[model samples]
Target: AANDLLSKAKLDASPDKVTLVIDPLIDGVTGSQSVATHLEEKRVIELVKSSYPRFQVARFSAESVAKSPIVLIGTFTAINNAGAATGPRDAYRICLALADLKTRTIISKGVARALPDGIDPTPVAFFAESPVFAKDASTDAYIKSCQGTKVGDTIDQAYADRIVVASLINDGIEAYDAGHYRDALDVYQAALKTPGGEQLRVLNGIYLANYKLHHTKAAMDAFGKVIDYGLKSDKLAVKFLFKPGSTQFSTDRSVRAPYDAWLEKISERTAAKQGCLEIVGNTSATGLPAINDRLSGLRADYVKDRLEDNEHSLRGRLIATGKGSREMIVGTGKDDASDALDRRVEFKTAKCAI
Candidate 1:
C-alpha cells in the first residue's frame, strides 16, 4: 500500500522539493470550527520531513503551488459524541490527495479516520490509523473501496455546507478584484446565509464590500462583528499607502483624507469594544530587507500614534509591529497602486483570555 501510494504520488524519483497545502478542516457539526486540522497537517509535514531528508518543504499558496506538486490534506466529516453514552466526544474522517499541478490530476488519494473504541468511547480513546490501499487494485479502485468503510457513530450533516460557503467567498473575492463592489456585496450576503457563514474571512469580505460601495453604516457594523469575535488570526487591511522609501503617509490630501476617516472609524470601534489591537505594517518588495523592516516598523508606530490620538483610551491596548516586505500579499514589488495592498497597514485583534 505504501509503495503503490508513493509511486502514484510521483515521488518515486524523489523530488527535491514539495509543497504542502492543508485546507482548514471544518467541524462537521459546527461547520465553522476547525477540528484539530492544523495539528494533523503539522504531523504529516513532520513525517514527510523526517522521511525525506533531502526534500525542501514549503507552505502551499495559490501562487506557490502552481509550479509544483502539492500534498493536500483536509477533513471531509466529523462527528461529536461518536459511540458515547453521555459525555462530549468527537471524531474526524480525513482525506489526503497528492495532485500534480502540471497535469491538474489527483495522482494519489487515501482516507483515514479517528474512531472511538466502543468500550471506551472517549475522545482520548479515539484511535486514528494510517491510510491503507487495497492490494491488486488500481489507485481509483482502492480509493473507492476505502470509501465504503464506516466506523463513526454519528454522521456530520453539515459537512458539505462549508464547501458552499467557501465557494461563495471565492466568488465574492473575484468580484471585489474586478471592481464590482455591488456584486461582491451580493455574494457575501449569500455566503452569510450558509453554515459557518460568520467566519472571519466572510465577515472581512462583507466589510470590505460594503466599504467599497460607500455603505458606511453597514461597513462599520460588519467591522464591529469582526471586533466582537476577537480572533487574533483575522486581519483587516488599512490602505494607508506610503511614499516609496518614506515612513510618512502620501502627501495628497485626497488620498490622506479617506485613510484619516478610516482610522477614525477604527478607533471609535476599538474603543467602543474595549478591544486590544496589533498594528502590523508591511511594505512592497522594492528595497533592502533592513530598510523595509525599519520603514515598516515606523509606519506601524505612526498608525498606533494616530489611533491613540483619536481615542486616548486605547493608549495601552495597542501594539505596533513590522513584517517588512517578507509577507507581501502581492509579490510584484511595484511601488504603485496595483501593489498598494502590499504596502499597507493591517489591524489584527488580540486574543483575549476567557
Candidate 2:
C-alpha cells in the first residue's frame, strides 16, 4: 500500500535529482562466490544495471557509493552491502551522517511511521503505513501525522470508544481504593457519561464508595444513576462491602450534594445506548460460621432487588451472587473493622448489542 502510494505521489512532485545506491545481501549466498571469484558479481551488477537502465551507478568504490543523492539499502542485513542495523535509529543516524557529507536529500525505506515532535525528518516521497488504536495515544499521534500527508487514514472510532471508557473506570477504581469517597464519586461521574462496558465498572466503583463507605446520600444518588441511565441489566455489574459485624457503610455523608450533581450528568448518556448493568458482591472475613456467609449473600441480593425496584427489565436477566470471605482486596481478617477496606460491592455493564 505504501509503495504504491509513494510511486504515484512522487511522479506529481518530482525532485531535482534522484540517485540509487545498493547494499549487498548478507551471507555466503549466490552473489558471494561471484564477488570473491571475479572480484565483482556480474550477475548482481547486471540486475541493478537492468533495473535502472537510465541512471548511472558507481562501480566498486565505497567513496563513490557514499556520494549518491539517493541510497537504496535492503530492508534486511546484506553481507555484500555490509551495513550496520537497518532499523529506524540506524536509518535516522545514516541520514544525519550523509547530511554532513553534502547530501541535500535522502531516499530510504527505513523511515518510521512517525518521528518525535521536535526532530524534523526531511520528507522524501516514500511509503510506509501502520494501523493505530485509541488505547495507544502515542500511535494515535503518529497516525494523525500520517493522515495529514495522505488524506486517507482515519482513527478507528470503536477503539477510541473503548479507550475512553476504560480510562474512566480505572480512574474511579483508583480513587475508591485510595479512600477518597467524593473523589471516587467524581471519577464515576466523569466515566458514566462515556460509552462502553467499562461504564458499568465505574458505576460499580461509585456504588461501593457510597454504600460501603457510609455516604448515604451519595449511595442514593448512585442508585438513582442506575435507574436514570437504564444500566441495571448486566448480570455481573454491581457489588458492595461492609465493616465486620455490621451492615453500615464506612464513610461520612458530607459530600452527598456534589455526588448527586455528577449522577445527573451520567443519566443523559444511558438513553443514547441500550445498556445493561451487572452486579458482583464481595466480603471480608470477620465473623462467625453462618453470619458472614448470610451477610455476603444478603448484600449481593440487596443490590439485585434495588435494580428491580428501579423499573429495569428483570425478566431473568439481572444476576447476583455472594463471594463469601474470598477475594480479599486487603489482608485483614473478618474480625477487623479497619479491614472495612475489604468489604465492598462492584457494579458494571455486562453486554450490549450495539
Candidate 3:
C-alpha cells in the first residue's frame, strides 16, 4: 500500500535545489501522532528510499528546509467500519500528499486501504501527556487537509498554511520529551511570535512547559488563555488525573497538586462570562459501568467543590454531571497514560444550571 502511494508522489526533487522532507503522519480524527501512524510513516519512508532509490528525499531536519522544499504529508484514519476482516481490530484509510512549499501547491497525491494488522492506536508521549482536549480550530484545519477523496489538484490550504509553524512546534515537542522543559518553553514562545502560531498545540505546549518548569504564574496565564480559546469554541476538557478508583487526587505531592491554582483560573475565566457551566467528569472504561458512572459523578462534584470554593458566586451557577465510559475519546480502556484523556473534567457553557 505504501509503495502504491509513494509511486504517485514526486519525491524525486532536484537534489541541489529542493529537499524532500516527510512530515510525520498523524491520526486523522484526533490529529495525534500515534504508534500506528509512526510505524506506517517509517514504512512509507523506507519504501521511498529502497523501492524508489532514484528519488532524492532527505531525512527530516532543520537544515533540509533551508533551501526550497517539497513536503510529504499524510494521514491514517481508523474507522469503525474499516471493512477489513480482522474481527474487532480497526482498518485504516491512508492518504499521502506531496506539497511544494515554494509554490504552495500539492503536486501529487496517493491513497490506499489498510487491513487490520494489530496496529496500535495509542497516542505518542507528548500527545498522551497533554492536559487538554486537543481538537480545536487548528486541529480541524489540519484534519481538513487530510480529508477528501481527491487531493493534489489544489493546494491543501490548512496543511500548507501550517507547515512552517508546525516545524517549530515539533521542535518544542522534541525538547519537552527530552526533559529540556526550559528549551521547550523558549521554542513554544518563539512559535507564539510567528504568524500562524496561535494554535491549540502551541498554546497547550506553552502551558505544559511552564507547568513543568514550576513557573506557576506563567502556567496559570497560559492555561487561562487555553480555557479562553476553548470557551470561544464552546467546550473545554481538562485532564485532571486522580487517585486510583477514587475522586481524590494522588498522594504524590506534586502530581496534580496545583488544583487550587487551576480552579482559580477556571473560576476567574468562567465567572467573567454570562452563562453558567456544566462540569462533566468522565472515567476510563476499566471498571463496572455502574460504578464508573457514580465515580465519574463524584469526580465532577469534586471539581465543582473546588471551583465553588475558589469563587462563592459559582456555587449555584455550576452543576456537576458524569458520563462514565459512555463517551470516550481514546476508548482504549488500558486505564493508564494511554487512556488518560478518557478520564477528564470538561467545562461546557450552559444557558442555565440546575
Candidate 4:
C-alpha cells in the first residue's frame, strides 16, 4: 500500500528539494488514532526514507515550523459488503496525502485498498478509555477532509476551520496516553478556549482528564457539556456492555465502574431537552437472529426503565426497540471488545410514543 501511494504522489517532480513532515494519521470514521493507523504511518515514513529520498522526511514539531514543510495526512475506512448482510470478506481503503499546512490545499494524494487480514482496529490509549461514541461535527469534518479531496482544492471547511488547534489537541492526547492527566487537562482546557478548538476531541478530553484527576464535580460538569453536544447532534451512542447471555450490566470493573456516571449524565441532559427519546439496542453477530432480537429488545427496555427511573421527565417519553444484528458498525462477529460497538445501546430523539 505504501508503494502504491508513493507511486501516485508527485515526489519525483523535484527529488532534490522536496521536504515532507509526517502528521499522525487518524481513523477517518472516528477522527481518532488507532494501532493500525500508527503502523501505517510508520510504514509510509520508512518507505519514503529508504525508497524515495527525493522527498526528505521530517518530524512534526515546533522546531520544524520554519521549514515550511508539506504535511502528510492519512485516513482509512472499512468497506463492507453491500446492504445489511455481512460479506464473506471485508476490505479497507487507506488514503494518504500531502497538504500545505498554511493553505489546507492538497498537493498530492494516493489511495490503496487491502484486506483486513491482521489489522488491529483497537483505538489508542485515550480513545480506548472513552465511554461514549465520540463521533460528532468534528469527526464528520475529518472524514470529509479524507475522502475526495482534490489535489489543488482545500480540505473540508469545518476541518480546515479547526486545523489551528490540531497540534495542541495532539499534545493533549499524547499527555493523556502517557498518564499525565493533569497536564492533558490543562492543554485541553486551554485548547477549548482557542478558536475552532472546541471540537469533540477537546470536549471529550476535558471530561476524561477531569474524571481521571478525581475531580468528580468538575468531571460531571465537563461531561454534561459533552452530553449536551452529543444530544444536540442526535448522534449519541453510549457503550453499554452486558453479561454473558443476559441483559444485566457487566460485572467487570471496566464495564460497570463508570456506568452510573454515564447514565446520570445522559439522564440529566435528555431531561433538560424534554424531547421524545428512543432507546435502541443491538447485538453482535455471534448470537442467533431470533434470540438476539428478543435479547436486544429486553436490553433496550432495561435502559429505558433505568433512564425513566433516573429522571421523572423521561417516564412516558421513552420507547425501546432492537435491531438484533441487522445494523452493525463493525461486523466482525468476534463478539468481543473488538466488536463492542456493535452491541451498543443508542439514544435517539423520536416522536412521543403514546
TM-score per prediction, in order, is 0.48, 0.30, 0.85, 0.90
How many clashes does each candidate structure show, in the order listed? 0, 36, 0, 0
Please, what are the lDDT tens digits per residue for candidate 4 over residues 281-305? Answer: 9998676899989999999999988
Residues 196-305 of candidate 3 have per-residue lDDT tens digits of 89888888899989988899889999989988888777788888889988888767664454766777888999878755888999997788989999999999999999
Q: Write the per-residue lDDT of candidate 1 for residues 1-354, one digit (tens) a residue.
A: 222333346454665555544433332222221225445556666766676544355644334444544434333343343554332335545555554444444556556567533312111100010000011112222233223322221112232224345556656765776678899889888888866776655666787778777988898778666544433335566567676677777787544435666677779888887888889899876778898899999999999999999999998899999999876643434365434556768788885432
* Candidate lDDT (C-alpha), each: 0.56, 0.38, 0.76, 0.77
Worst 10 residues of 4 by lDDT: 80-89
Better candidate by lDDT, 1 or 3: 3
lDDT of 2 by residue, 1-354 (tens): 223222322221454434443332111111111112122223334654665443344432334434633322211111212233321222111100011112222221222222222322211110000000012232232232222222222323442334445445445554565566678677777766655543334544566667657877776665555444333332222212344455443344431223223323332333234444455566765566367667776776665665455444442444556676664443224233223334555445656433
- Candidate 3: give its CA RMSD in angstroms: 3.5
Cα TM-score of candidate 3: 0.85
Off by over 4 Å in 3: 10-18, 59-68, 81-93, 102-105, 110-118, 252-257, 352-354
Clashing residue pairs in candidate 4, if any? none
